[model samples]
Target: MAKEHSLDLIAIGRSCADLYGQQTGGRLEDMLSFAKYVGGSPTNTAVGAARLGLRTGLLTRVGEDHFGRFIGEQLAREGVSTQGVIADPQRLTALAFLGIRDPDTFPLVFYRENCADMALCVEDVDPAFIRSAGAVLISGTHLSQPQVFEASLQACRIAREAGARVIFDVDYRPVLWGLAGRDRGDDRFVAHEGVTARLQEALPLCDLIVGTEEEIHILGGTTDTLAALRAIRARTDACLVCKRGAAGCSVFAAAIPARLDDGLTGRGFAVEVFNVLGAGDAFMAGFLRGWLRGEPLEVCSDWANACGAIVVSRHGCAPAMPTWVELQAFLRGGDRPFRLREDAALEQLHWATTRSGRYDELMVLAVDHRSQFEELCRQTGADPARLPAFKALALRAVDRVAGGDPRFGVLLDGRYGMRALEAAADHPYWIGRPIELPGSCPLAFEGSADVATELASWPYNHVVKCLVLCHPDDADELRERQERQLLRLHDAARKTRHELLLEIIASRNGQIDDHTVSRAMQRLYDLGLRPDWWKLEPSDSAAAWRNIERTIAANDPHCRGVVLLGLSAPEEELAASFRAAAQVPIVKGFAVGRTIFADAAEQWLAGRIDDAGAIDDLAARFAALVEAWRAARTHGAPADREIA
Candidate 1:
């Protein structure tokens, strides 16, 4: 087949045979009934871009086996030009087994060894075809192997030399590199060292770099979005784009000569997500479409966010992507309401809780409380008829706090031999479960003894600190103990090479002492320990800034980074202080928590919390806060520059 003259996009990479299964139960061992689907980043991007009304072509090498035929048929069905895809008789097609265990966790197992995709050589990609395309989209996974790496880089160089814009998606997969014989040692899968090295080589030649916040962090070794952006911009002139699932996307461009907006501004649009599997590809497709149409960067981001929102509401990758018309309709209309039955919602919550590392059986006790409350309402003294109204009020309370509604609720007019026909509500014990917030690393406990072990056990990449409830009167003592414990834990973690985290409740203490901090740092150094990052309650005091600076200077080479949690500090001073201290490059990133949990707890404790409405509000607010923090970091003056 001959190549087309002018293509909107030339997506070059792997085409895999996919095996998919939907989870019947929340447990990992639960028997799952699954269905097969076509999967691969390159194929998905081509299909996604085509569905968004682009004339897209795919350039890859596939086996002459049944999987290859399937890939060809799927691409043709999706309207992607596949003339450039080559069929290799020497190798078998790559295969991937995908399991959607629940909304938050999806596990994938790949069987790719000397696959046809890796068989692609420089000759397989046509120089003239790449030159004819408006943009060339390359996946980072393919670059793990030496043969494909060289070939893909050659294609990127050819496209660049031809004046074509190149888009690089840093889809880092440690397994893929391992298959290529790269020994990463202890930092094997999680660190993604090989992929980062490859990205460094390709990034300088590309016009755009598209990656998730996690991917960027892995490549740049920082969770701060702006730091990641600056790191990439420092190496290349590509328009840097960082994808924040559900919250939105950010675009950073260098200050050009006489360009409008200077491309340093950041913006976000809200999104409702259902299945986040291929949302990134959808965003890339939408962004490319907008960029091709000469739209503003902000509008491109909005379109990308809209497209991602549309896909997450549906199931699967290619099947979920909306056509250009559907995307337009969705944009014209408001947010799509989630259509979930009560049973479905319950099942989802159950699945979410089970897979969420944050919540264990002990922490999630609301189900039992609801059952007990029902029995109490059935007693003789209770007015059974008033139970319904009272239950409604109690339900409102559960809606007020973080993870409150789905995991808890209230019942009214319980009999329990009471003379008055009154309603009752109870606070449920909270089990902290790991949550993967958009645009940040998976959170872990600050003072955890086995950080790596705990991180491995976590279902997702990020870990948030568990709530530490200390009595107001004992706050000072608790703070002191926590500081002492943190020092000991830091020493222990260094010996074990585990990441240490220390989370202190700001509302409990009202303030932190320098003595405690000094002792903590001294102990950290004594044990040869440095944290990946520390999450502290934001403060404006000179002491806090000084502590941060000193800590970063001391642990510059050893620590991953430091992040200031909670958005209570003055933004101007915080930024200024961060920049001044960021003189050391190893002081990688910064972040702030939204205070959603605090706000929700305050409402629940104050008797103003609503059960039914709280969960969604909390999630939305949390997502919004993360979006704002990321935006500020992206657009904030360089960490070395003082705030004006």
Candidate 2:
């Protein structure tokens, strides 16, 4: 292998979306919805390697559709290079709809029949880019088609010629071959002489080969597992890994003899099985991590086993792969009190480490309160048609803060702020949109299920900010239902690939204080609602913030940090609150709605203030808050004081 390469690994072939039904223990026909996640073996492996802190890239073709965009964005988010992931404008991206009918049977249907991935041609293969990789991983399915087969071989040959190791993942999928009219039923694994011949040609060039027993059997042209291993060994001296589900795995390198009970084997981490579909891809990713890092054979196997164990017990393919920290934590201890599959800490670690872009601390402008603006219009005797103008004020504020301050975003709604959102979409600025009704104490959504539908239509850049009017003192039934709804919203946000910014407001009917807000947040955390950012009411004291921070750290330290909310207070009052919030390091910035725009909006609605005047006033108010926040963040927290 080359001593230096631009990429640690470049994975080639199929990329698709895996929509796994959340309703487990049911038929696909009975399921109402499925969770969308990035799928395809090579794509998963690339993402997994990237998650393990490897500089990886993917070589594949995805349709010009949203699913293809999602796959690209997801890869980029995981720090995987997508230079070779071509966007085929004519074809649709492949999809795999899977359902967990039981522990053993996972109902899967492939939607790839002449899909974008299958159309991969040698013309699409960039030889120079392939040569830059330390290793090139060729997926077995890529060899099913003549064009993709040629492309895969071309890339592999180029990488090998450049002193790059060629790794072959025998990711045998009978359904894919069947689509090519080469195989029968996907469930029936038969060793085709032609397929074996093609695989054998690539095996001689591989430095490493990983596969399940079935995959190995196909490549070695035998049903007997041992015979297959021997045949493969005779053909090439490449290190071979055989993945045995739950029994761990066995590694057969040049130095070790393969046996049932010996030769560089590692025990698999025991996990409660949920789905076993993507375990192999996760295993390959883990193995690549250890191999590239020059870990011992046993350690590499352990890493592979750990990754496989974690993914098998989770939901989807690439998303289920563990981060480096999560893997280390799993290796150190078993899933313990909180199962590793569902551990919030591990989830947060993935969230924190897998950031796609780097941005400075946020300075958000809140303009997403739909009902509040309507109420203001009603009180001021102005037509509701003027709401868009009111929202434009917030956009104007955002424009004013643009170049001068880099860390600014606006929280607007599609209802009143569609223009603002469309405009912001053209620029590279942070944007948050509310998905809840204004003053529903029980946390009713403004459009209920339609909120998710709206979210689906939005660009990936917008944040889904849901305002749940929470009260610790609310009835248990209401609290439980609210929790359920928020959980649904959280899942929907994840489906749409939007960063959730959960805004929680403690009910003023009770003694609305920091303690109440803290408890409310804790309750949600207990319910497993970990948002990327928390839009919180400003705490009265530093002690209150400390309490909230403790809960956040324990629950999800990967949280993007909290932002103070303005309850339509005066500029001075909001400034005082900003000072207190800025003292807390966990507080990134503020999202003040009324304090900045309510009065100006009201005056504009009443025709007392012109568009320029209203925009100017809103800009000035927003600027004042920004100044206060920047000063507070710079000078540090002030002395502790009691709330008046």
Candidate 3:
């Protein structure tokens, strides 16, 4: 297929933003908070297929607003081609507000009054884009409108001309067809001959037709399942897949069977359902993932059912779609948990695979010191208010050293370095904010007891850094307390969509065994706390680094590599440490503070150096450290620039 086509599938239809109510088992009217996600059937399918390693694209129109740009950016991040996605300047992006009141009741409100997705016109359909895909997927919602109906039909014609398969997902929505009230957006079907006739026009152009029983009833003009299948059979020779909810699904590629299960069938999971909103889209995506590869019908059905089951057990659709890794794990046939979302390993893979970023080499500056700054101010008798400007100056030094580089990051705190964080966030620099209170033995957040609430005001780009001085040999009570705190912070990070970077040291008072630090990491993973990045102190030997990396790889292979933390060591010692670290591939880079800026900051605070001198000194020191790191990673001679 790759030799003949550039893409596996092209999904054409509505695209919109979904704002889901956060209050589960609560009425939509009483919901307090919400989370935004990119939604719509074809958009979800494209994202689901892309996450399963399929080359897919979307053909739709979004409003020329923040949500529109957001949809485009998110699709691109999900590995779906957005070249065919156009923006309609005259309309606002569509939005859906949904709530889960019970297992069966999902109250939804769709804000799509002349929305952007419905603005897709015939002129927006590109023949080449449709032809390059192995198949084209057109949802039934787009056929309800005049302009988009013509555009979807044109795409089908192009696909037919190019010998590429055309797939029709009979995504029947009664409210969308004007058969229900505006507030009844969740209505599945209505006995409307007009809507069925409109859908029949597009069915004959399809090579594969997928729909639920009610949807087939809408398409085939009958309430009886077999009669509806026969009616659809008479219109086209395309394969028919009838979803049977929790009973699984049946696939009939030839004649209609005497009974539904008499045809080829795939078994479904016996797990409980949460929200049945996006399961059908997930089912179609899973079907195409196998169907495009020319797999057997039974295999495709199994994948389809499993995908649907997975999504039905989760909250949001696009974000809840299972990746290839998670699918494989679930299909292994074992005594499984009651809910797929409760599987730690599966959830970890989902979080890791869906994350969007690249930090091949993260060279971050460590300036998120709180207690140290206070001590410096106390010693120098300088006003505490000067610290914000000092931190801003520190950022300027980093800017002069490395401007707008994604690899260069700084760790700052909101208590003192909020101004610097505001400035650094505007550029492309990777930024991290520390939340752990300084000198807290068992660990505590710097501000409110509710860490998650405190992290709400942070920007999305700012990573959450927590310094834990945990020793494996510590008393069990103390260790348990520390682990509990770590779990809370980890949950907060996930809730806020911020990456967590754990600085795991044996103890700040002195050096414990290097092995103890590695053991601490393993224990954290056992608690189901998988941090994205690990910040560790430099090891004395290469073997220690190997063991540490092995522990991380075994627990969560998707873990971002480790960063070497500078404990304000001497310049010569740090240079030697960097050279030795070159022997380990897991160390991405270093996050050093005192080694690069301690002496310079001290001199500036003592009035021994002006601001310009301090900036010049910090920049040169940082640049030299960066060069030394490059040399170590590249097998070049160790750099000789002095910092002390």
> Candidate 3's residue-wise lDDT over 1-644, tens digit each?
53488898999998999899888997899999888889999999999988787999999999999999989989988999998999999999999898888988998888889998898988999888888898899989889999999999999999988888999999998888788998888888899989989999987899999999999999999999999999999999999999999999999999998999898988988877989988999999899989988899999999999899889988898988989888887888677688767776777777887888777787877888988988888898878788888788889898888877878888888999999999986677889889999979889888877999888878777889999988777788888899899999998898778899999878663466647778888989889899999998876577777778889888888988888888987766777778777677778998889877787777888789989998998888888778878877887873564534
Residue-pair clashes per prediction, in order, are 26, 0, 0
Ranking by lDDT: 3, 2, 1
What's the true lDDT of residue 620 in model 3?
Answer: 84
In candidate 3, how many Å is residue 212 off? 1.1
| Candidate 2 structure, TM-score to reference | 0.85
lDDT of 1 by residue, 349-377 (tens): 22222121121111011111222333444
**lDDT winner among the candidates?**
3
Best of the two (1, 2) by lDDT: 2
TM-score of each: 0.49, 0.85, 0.95
Error of 3 at 576 (Å): 1.9
What shift in Å separates residue 120 of candidate 1 from its native position after superposition? Answer: 1.4
Query: Between the candidate structures 1 and 3, which one is better when assessed by lDDT?
Result: 3
TM-score of 1: 0.49
Could you give candidate 2's per-residue lDDT for residues 1-644 as a string of tens digits? Answer: 43677899999998999998878888888998777889898999999988888899999999999999999978877889999999999999999888888887787888887799989999998888897789999988789888888899899888878888989999887767763343222353666888888888888789999988889899989988777888998989999888888889888886435454565677877677788888898999999999988899888899999899888877788887888988897788744532455665665565565545655478777888788888998999988888886787678767877664547888989788888888776566678987777777677676546667767777777888888877888888888888888988887876566888888777564677657778888888887787988988775577778888888888887778888888877666666777767777788888888778877888888989898898788888777777777767787434332222
